[model samples]
Target: MALALSLKVAGLAAAATTILGVAVGFLLARASFPGRNVLDTLLTLPMVLPPTVLGYYLLVLLGRRSALGTWLLEEFGINLIFTWQGAVIAASVVAFPLVFKPARAAFESVDGQLEQAARVLGTSNTAVFFRVTLPLAWRGILAGVLLSFARALGEFGATLMVAGSIPGKTQTLSIAVYEAVQAGQDDVANTLVYIISAVCVAVLLTAGHLAPGRIARR
Candidate 1:
């Protein structure tokens, strides 16, 4: 159950990060405007902040007592706290920088001339992005997404704070390992640890192979 839940949360988080990260990365790479640097720093802040600190912030922003949370609950009948969906949100936020940074770098590394040529040939801006830019940057973006998935899969602190350890619901592999350790179940803890470590190592290896530098060299 823990492994299944972990995979589900990480998959959802990776999907969310891919869409938002790619859009924001493209915007940041192509546009010049005031506060761009500030926005970049804010987007990248999760990478450096303590996980518990991020969890606290998420709780304040998404808890029932908060305005957004209140509106969501009142209008949409949605409550994020102590739920698997909340775990997804927590994992997404924590893993976002893994996607965002690589996405931005990948987009930025794309040759402007190719996009310009597409535009000169009367291709729509959207088409230029799809046909000319995305293909070129996909390797790096995919590498980021893979890393984000691994990060989300192993997320512990923020998910624990927002989603709690609900067995078969919110108890992801990492959280299960924590519980096992706390309960002095050494065998269970070791098993979970080995599973998560193996998965993460596989993801890291794939991401490394698909990295922009390696792709460029290839």
Candidate 2:
């Protein structure tokens, strides 16, 4: 059950990350504006910041006392604190940078000349991006998606902070292993650890297969 929940949350987070990451990444790769560098730095901050610090920021931003949180509660009665939804948000926040960086790199690698030619031929920017740029960069974007999913699956500190490891509610695989170890259940911890390791390895292998050229370049 914990494993299932973990996958569920991670999957949802990864999907959300992919949508937002792809947009932000493409913008970063192709567009330039006054605050582009600042936006890029802000987007990538989670990668370098400590997880606990990130969690704390999320808590402050989404907790009931904050304006958005208060509006959510009053308008929709949707509470993010200690909910599975909150877990998804926390995981997404931390995993976003992982997805963004590779996706941005992939977008940047695509031949700008091709896009320009397509535009000259009367293809709309949206059509050109979807039919040209995205298809060309899909391999690296897929790798980023896989990496984001793996990162989301393994998220611990932020999840614990926002979701509280509630049994059968937000107790993800990582939290389960943590609680198991705290209770001296070595066998349980080991089993969960092994499962997580296997999942991570599989994701990495698939990602590598998808972007062998990128891997080789790195």
Best by TM-score: 1
Q: Which candidate gets the maximum lDDT versus the true structure? A: 1
lDDT of each: 0.95, 0.95
What does candidate 1 score on TM? Answer: 0.99
Off by over 4 Å in 2: 212-218
Q: After superposition, how far is residue 83 of candidate 1 from its true place, in Å?
A: 0.2
Measured on C-alpha atoms, candidate 1 has an lDDT of: 0.95
* Model 2 TM-score on a 0 to 1 scale: 0.97
Give the lDDT of residue 164 in candidate 2. Answer: 89
lDDT of 1 by residue, 1-218 (tens): 99999999999999999999999999999999999999999999999998899999999999999999999999999999999999999999999999999999999999999999999999999999999999999999999999999999999999999999999988999999999999999999999999999999999999999988876687
Q: After superposition, how far is residue 193 of candidate 1 from its true place, in Å?
A: 0.8
Residue 172 in candidate 1, Cα distance off native in Å: 0.6
State the lDDT of candidate 2 residue by residue for 1-218, as single tens digits.
Answer: 99999999999999999999999999999988899999999999989888899899999999999999999999999999999999999999999998999899999999999999999999999999999999999989999999999999999999999888899999999999999999999999999999999999999999888884955677
